[model samples]
Target: MKTRAAEGGTGGVRRRPTLLSNAETWAQLAVAARIGPEAYAAVGTAAEPGTVLLTVNRPGPGPVVVEAPFGTRLGDVLHACGLRPGDSVLVGGYHGAWLGPVDAAGASLSRTGLAELGATLGAGAIVALPAVTCPLGEITRVAAWLAGESAGQCGPCRRGLPDAADALVALATGAGGPAGLEDVRRALGGAQGGGACSHPDGTARFVLSALDVFAPDVEAHIAGPGCGRPVLGVLPLPRGEGARLEVDWSRCAGHGLCGVLAPGLVRLGPHGYPASTTIPVAPWQEHGARRAVSQCPALALRMRRPERGPGRLR
Candidate 1:
């Protein structure tokens, strides 16, 4: 491809084959030789040489096809390297995280990055999950943080995430039941796909992915039984402590009163106690959140918006 550079400078001529069309482009030319001819004509005014081109390879024992960017996600590459099936992996950059086994053998790691891990390598992403960690608990903790990171612009996300986080936490701690499960569904319905940004969507994706990947754990929780394991906190999240709400199921008594006080903020479970939403509380709604927090008759509800800024949420 022949292109121009800056004002008077002549752009360099480059040549390369389309990987999609010719899978062995790199293997034929070899990364060391750097001698491939331009495969297609360059676009634009030719005043710009375009930007840098990177070819990331997916880890495998077969032919290496180059993804647009050279450095694909480390986790995805590892998964392609034959990590055990159902191995939970982190996506996105450092901020994004998720836990799910590699279900689809050919599942590309691009889109999976953002919804789960707050990061993606424009192709693949980092993958790692150990046997000791509880994927459900790890997802719950990350969901809580994702909720707190919301910009709080929309009503649903602002009010839905914390509620979802609360339910997840309850499940994780063995204090939840069918009622908590209903709460999760409600929170997901209200917050997901409702915000201008993907914050709420991202949070929902994380939770839903957990539901799919940790069926055993969810089943154990729903059976009114414990997983008999402690939360391992395997997925990496922002450093430091975050504000959190506590629900004492023992004191809850299923009065169904909290829902009456804050309909948008809370829902009544099948068993009757108020269930919170998964939406993060926005700065503007702090007062309303506090009101809901103070009015709980069972004193089972509390709101913990983190003290730190955006960084804390991620």
Candidate 2:
């Protein structure tokens, strides 16, 4: 990797304090560089200023830094690093995938790449896992976090995510049965593609992949929780607070109250959940929107403007 220095406006120059590496390697290097050489020596690892490090499950017996093509997906990045088709590929960071061998030949490493694999690069993180790790357990843990990270904006995400997480957690902890798994299915099915943002969709994909990659785990959990392990968090979450809104699916009960209350801002989902319209409420509608927020029965509603600062949501 090439190191670049920053130049000041007053004709002074300074070395950039940070190293540039691929997302996964950079995160690891950041921690290693923090404690300096003595600490690194204690761990038997050394840091090179311009050298980038990557964490691959099955690395070749040589030194290499992959040059991913522009628009490469996480899968594509792995492929560039010599990952082969039918090799087990992890998606969505640690909290992401623990599934089957993916067809890397057909997978890309860009957002588009993971999309083709029914996943997202999500900060361009991708790690491979050996079959030794339980895929279902991995996904179940991620699903729980995804649910908890909800902004409490839309009704489905706010309620459905937590519920889905509970179900997954139950399975992970060996307390859930087929009925519990069914509840997870219901929660996933209901929450899938149902949110003002992609939060719900992303959460659903994580859970679905767990079911796909760990079909045996799902069966084991349903037959009677058989896995004996704690969930490990591997996914990355967005930093700081995110955008917010208010929606109540209960008072809604598919009554289309929001659509009627704020026609331009709400619509009905196929499953009777309140779906948000792309049209934002005009400034003039703020008063009425607040009224709808108050009138919600299931208390499934909210409205919040983003905090403002440099690069903050305006």
Candidate 3:
């Protein structure tokens, strides 16, 4: 009988009815209220009014969040801020899609505008992936971050995210082969369904779009010894620990099973406890690691798989 709108609402916490708007939506609403309709309408399109904040990143003095009209073309916006004509853009933030120079040529900044380009104003951000950084690595980091952010409640999120992350790592590190791409795509498809929330689905969309936009980069990572650039960590994620292959410390009894099974990676200490470096399972060695994991007497080793998969959108 009561309501909660995420600010304590009509009811108290955990009341039956609730309405939740993301932080940006709430902020936009506040701005709209303060500015009044006429002034807001004067700045934007007829369909959507007022300004939207854009976090612009380029090879320059700033990545400041600028307020721009809703119907303004993104390319013009970039040009005004010093982006060259040929520079590529990735829209919708980490959870958004990549846009080529052409796709962004005359695209509007509104919801309807981006929808035409198969994108949404996700978190209202844009990043210019410079020519120097290895985009594959950046995407991988974002994917890994999303995987770690999971509540670990869904099967697909549990497996898919790590799998995707690993594939990205392998691809960037020159360890992933053809199987890495296959594994990534498969994980994305499998993880697309069945979740308590939209996190899995939204994350899938984000990664998949990168795959399409960065096909050349992906191929280069797959076909050879990497794309000749280091991962610049351009994409942002929550600071703490990134996603990792974890072990259940309590359950480990130092049986030496993991070391015997995956000798190259899992080393046993003097007390027979399994220890691993920050390295991941290589493509050729994954089968051995899986065998060791299945045979562990203590069942302590827990390697995170990459469900951080993406689909084509370039």
TM-score of 2: 0.48
- Residue-by-residue lDDT tens digits, candidate 2, 1-314: 43343432233235334444566676656766897745544532132222223344443353244544334334555666675423256655543443356454356445554565666545434556444455566666456446546566777775677667666766666666777778788987887777898778777766767676667767876676565544443233343333334554344465555546754344445565664412233344466567667775566667765466532543
List TM-scores for all candidates, in order: 0.55, 0.48, 0.70
The ten-residue window of minimal lDDT in model 2 covers 44-53
Scored by Cα lDDT, where does model 3 land?
A: 0.71
> Which sequence of candidate numbers ranks them by lDDT, best first?
3, 1, 2
Residue 265's lDDT in candidate 2: 40
Which regions in candidate 3 have their CA more than 4 angstroms from the true location? 1-36, 58-62, 84-87, 242-314
Per-model clash counts, in order, read: 36, 14, 19
List candidate 1 stretches off by more than 4 Å.
1-76, 79-86, 93-100, 104-106, 110-127, 243-314
Candidate 3 vs. true structure, TM-score: 0.70
Model 2: residues >4 Å from true position, as ranges? 1-66, 70-88, 92-99, 102-106, 110-114, 228-314
- The candidate scoring highest on lDDT is 3
* Candidate 2 positional error at 86, Å: 10
Give me the overall lDDT of model 1.
Answer: 0.56
